[model samples]
Target: MGSSARLRQFVHDNGPLILDGGLATELEAQGAKLQGDPLWSARLLHTNPQAIRDAHSRFLLSGADIIATVTYQASIPGFIRHLDVSAERARELLMSGVHLAKETVTRFDSGHQRPLVAGSVGPYGAFLRDGSEYTGAYAAEMSVEELKVWHRPQIDCLAAAGADLIAFETIPSIKEAEAVVELLREFPDTTAWLSFSCKDGKCISDGSLFTEAVQVARRSTQLLAVGVNCCPPDVVEPLLDSAASLQSPDMSWVVYPNSGEDWNPERGWKTSEKLSATIPELSHTWLKQGAALIGGCCRIGPALIAQLRRELKGDCTPAASAEPS
Candidate 1:
């Protein structure tokens, strides 16, 4: 079976799925910067593919069953930031991510365990933090025509890249989400999983809750699944609480939350706690609360993932203990 088929089976049998952590932080740590161009966040794609690959390997070692490709900020205008990463170049980056993610498993999986490679399509913004700003402020109306022109190359690339499934993450508004969802409608052979990001109140910048977001994504072609990302873990419980009872006849509930609270852009974020422990605790709670899939957003990394693997291997401390008390 192809990798995506295998992962599809994995999701079906496990019911609950697990994905990897952020890539930009790891890349930045390895020497990525916002040179002059400010659009394409994956500026290091051609010049620093190894850095991206290294980040994926780290997540795999941390026990991630799936790792997303590094095309999050690879839009055309976004690509023009560093060098001229044309739309075709953007396509190459997406495919390259799949190749590297798959290779990581082959290279490091000592026994027979290997993770799935998922292609990640971030919002219309930069990364997660500045991601929200990408919506509303950009051209009025999101412009489906513009999106079709902008996203076609990337979509074709992902479909041809053998990604397990396209993960559309950190979307702040419904229009932006719908535009991509519309693209998925054209590609019946490929499946997509859309995850949105919200403000403090659990409402999307477009003012929809997880319910509305899920509904929109569901209509966008039986999307493999739908959920939230880049929001706080504290909000995860509440959002799950709000959506848990609402049965989706078609879609699965996936939640990829941030390690801690949202960072304040004004003074910047400073967490008093250690991520080594906090992030796993947060994910543990998410898993117990019926989240069909779980992962981390900004700042969370391999160490947190390792903690989760340790906890999962040991029975996850009993569902009762994992409950947010």
Candidate 2:
């Protein structure tokens, strides 16, 4: 079977496929200072690639079925502007994100199923580094064609680097979702999944209805899955429930929410006193709701991934429990 087909089949035979936790979260736990860097974790691709490799290795060992490359904020223009590198060199850095993940997968002896590498394609607001990704306020100003133009080079490099699939994650608006779905036609063989960054149970970050966003994603046959990401965990079930009837059978619901904490652009993640449901507990409900691809986003670490694996697989082996830094 082809890689895309394998992904579908895995979900069919197994339950929801376990995706890796936050790359930046793990990197910070390992002592990488990323605050104020426009490139975010992508900067480490040029500065400390081994750190990237090591982070991927940890998730694999923690039982992630798929690990996304650290290219969430990587773009040719961003690299040129921030890293002061030429376009060619910037492209190389983008491709290296995939290479590092592939290399990590190659070296790991999991002795089980091989994990897939997903090329991370974060929203344009991520490149802006102004917290617009959460609001999707920028999408209103950009046309679909213009968004495609900005996203083209990164998509081209990721596909060229041989990612198992593209992960168009944390998209905040239906417009950007439409642009990405349309862009998938250019890479006919590349299968991808589009996940939105939602504000509540029913709406995405731009205040667009999540149901409408899923409809936009449905326009692309190349998209193997569609759902929400980087949003609070509490909202995922209702989002899926509201759009349940609209979901296509062939397209799975891919949900990987954050730790149910709120984000403050100026102060970063706000501390919460209210305890929230763990991923494993919530995942059971998501699986029942037909979420086939599941994992974590911000503040989710390898330890939680390991715990999730054990919970879903019913393994009794002890796993790491260190909280994310």
The best candidate by lDDT is: 2
Residues 1-325, candidate 1: write the lDDT tens digits. Answer: 6433554566777645567776665655556773333533366566667777678767766667778887877665555444565766655665776777666666664342356677877665553244354243452555866766666767777778787678888777777777888888777777778777766545765666766766677675447677787776666667766666664545666777766644654444456454335656666676676556677766667766666666554432111111111
Flag regions of model 1 displaced more than 4 Å.
1-8, 34-41, 85-87, 110-113, 127-140, 261-276, 313-325
**What would the per-residue lDDT of candidate 2 be over residues 1-325, giving only the tens digit for each residue?**
6556766777788766889999998999899988788888999999999888888888887888899999999999999999999999999999999999998887776566667899999999999888888999998899999999989999999999999999999999888999999998999889999999999999999999999998998898778899998988889999999999988777999989888888876778786634234777888899889888999998888888888888777763233332111
lDDT accuracy of residue 117 in candidate 1: 72
Query: For each candidate, what TM-score against the reference?
Result: 0.82, 0.95
Identify the candidate with maximal TM-score: 2
- TM-score for predicted model 1 compared with the true structure: 0.82
Worst 10 residues of 1 by lDDT: 316-325
RMSD of 1: 6.1
How many clashes would you count in candidate 1? 3
